[model samples]
Target: MNKQQTETMQNTLAQNKNLLQNEQTLVNKQVGLNINKNSENLDDLLEFVKKETQTFKDISARGSSYVSIVKSENGTRFVINKATNEKLGYPTEIYIGYKDEHLMIFNAEGMAVNKLTVRQTKNKITIYNTKLVDEIINHFGIDFSEITSKSFAEGYFENKGREILYVKLL
Candidate 1:
């Protein structure tokens, strides 16, 4: 072959090789993205299954001392029913204050005489004083399982119609 023709053929081959490598890289990247997308879809499906299968907790207390324990795919929380605006019979804002590792419960009027607190772990809920828990359960008619069967546990008291306060014992 002529020298010029040989050089031209070499350049064409090199360009083809470069193009093929670039295409391969793109294909590999697309494969990786597909795998990640599949895993993300699987994660979403798993969460949906968990939420559908799990049962939320509902506990009723007596004399404006109702509590609802709720859990979802996201997390768990305790709700005080009587603290709602409907139960309050007026518009009020709940205030929270921290004192000696206990949460001071208050409303628009003033601080409550009986301070309530809760200690929750991954599987258990413990009130600062068992007596308070018992009083709520006995006098106020609060009903809750001694041990939670779910992945997370929570307990709280209602401050206002929409204000649920939690105590920090940790």
Candidate 2:
């Protein structure tokens, strides 16, 4: 192998490692976060983030870092209105991917309306709101009791040494 190629591979691997580490850290923090809509003002919560946490960045098609902005709200902290970004009649959902690659679908306030996951295919990268997906799947099997219908559909399953809450249906 050429030296240049070797160096390139090493650099790629290092970046991947950093991304994984940063993502894991963010996940740990997310577990401790109060993600209730109609709760608090996002501006103040973001201020807390600025004071108590350090932001990490990455280079990816999805995003390099999260862009936190004050939504068009007066003073409420929890705003999860998907229709806020309506152009004509489209209720386009705007989500924010956090430092740990955890996708949060908010309604406009800082409150977390839903969660998303990042997945990779052979030639494509996709993201989806997991909570919505779960809701659909659950509705289809409404007759079944909680977590007893499907083995793979168990929201509380321990997968990959972590508790997976939902899956992105893409």
Candidate 3:
């Protein structure tokens, strides 16, 4: 081939090589971006799965013998589980008192102070007192709007020769 024709051929080959390199660089960048996006999505999915697993474990680990405070638009109710009610001999009347951040449930047979009537069922004993519930909420500094109910474990003990079923607030 003539010198001019040969030089033209070399230039064309160089231009083609440069174009190929540019195309490869673009492809590499696109692949890198896809990998980063997929990694972020995977992290989000794993976090969601972890939260769901923890919720399931919490629900499954709860015990039946517990005291619960339930709130509603009408009022609030304190509930004692069947095991606790049986332990207390299923009293129709109880005296509810609070001191030192502890909720005290006393048998009403020998007590005459702040007697509260309670409803007893096969599964639970329920006490309904709106004022008492409000006082507890205020004392505990609890967010009433965020919580619908809370449960606690109880201890039966004797204080000053009196048997009491008490729940310590958190």
On TM-score, the candidate that comes out on top is: 3
Off by over 4 Å in 2: 33-170
- lDDT string, candidate 1, 1-170, tens digits: 99999999999999999999788779756644323433524444435444644433433224333333333343345443444323433223334344443343444445554434433333233223334434333443333445431211223444435444443322
Q: Per-residue alpha-carbon lDDT of model 2 for 4-59, expressed as tens digits? A: 99999999999999999788778757745544458645565655665877543322
Ranking by TM-score: 3, 1, 2
TM per model?
0.21, 0.21, 0.55
Look at candidate 1 and give me any clashing residue pairs. 83-160, 83-161, 84-161, 85-161
Candidate 1 lDDT (Cα, whole model)?
0.42
lDDT of 2: 0.36
Model 1's number of clashes is 4
Q: Look at candidate 2 and tell me the lDDT of residue 62.
A: 27
* Model 2: residue 117 alpha-carbon error in angstroms: 48
Candidate 3 C-alpha lDDT tens digits along 1-170: 99999999999999999999788778756644223433524444445444643322233125553577878776698788887777666877777777776777766756667787787877588777778777777886656587788777633344444457776654
Residue pairs in clash, model 2: 40-77, 41-77, 79-107, 79-108, 79-109, 80-107, 81-107
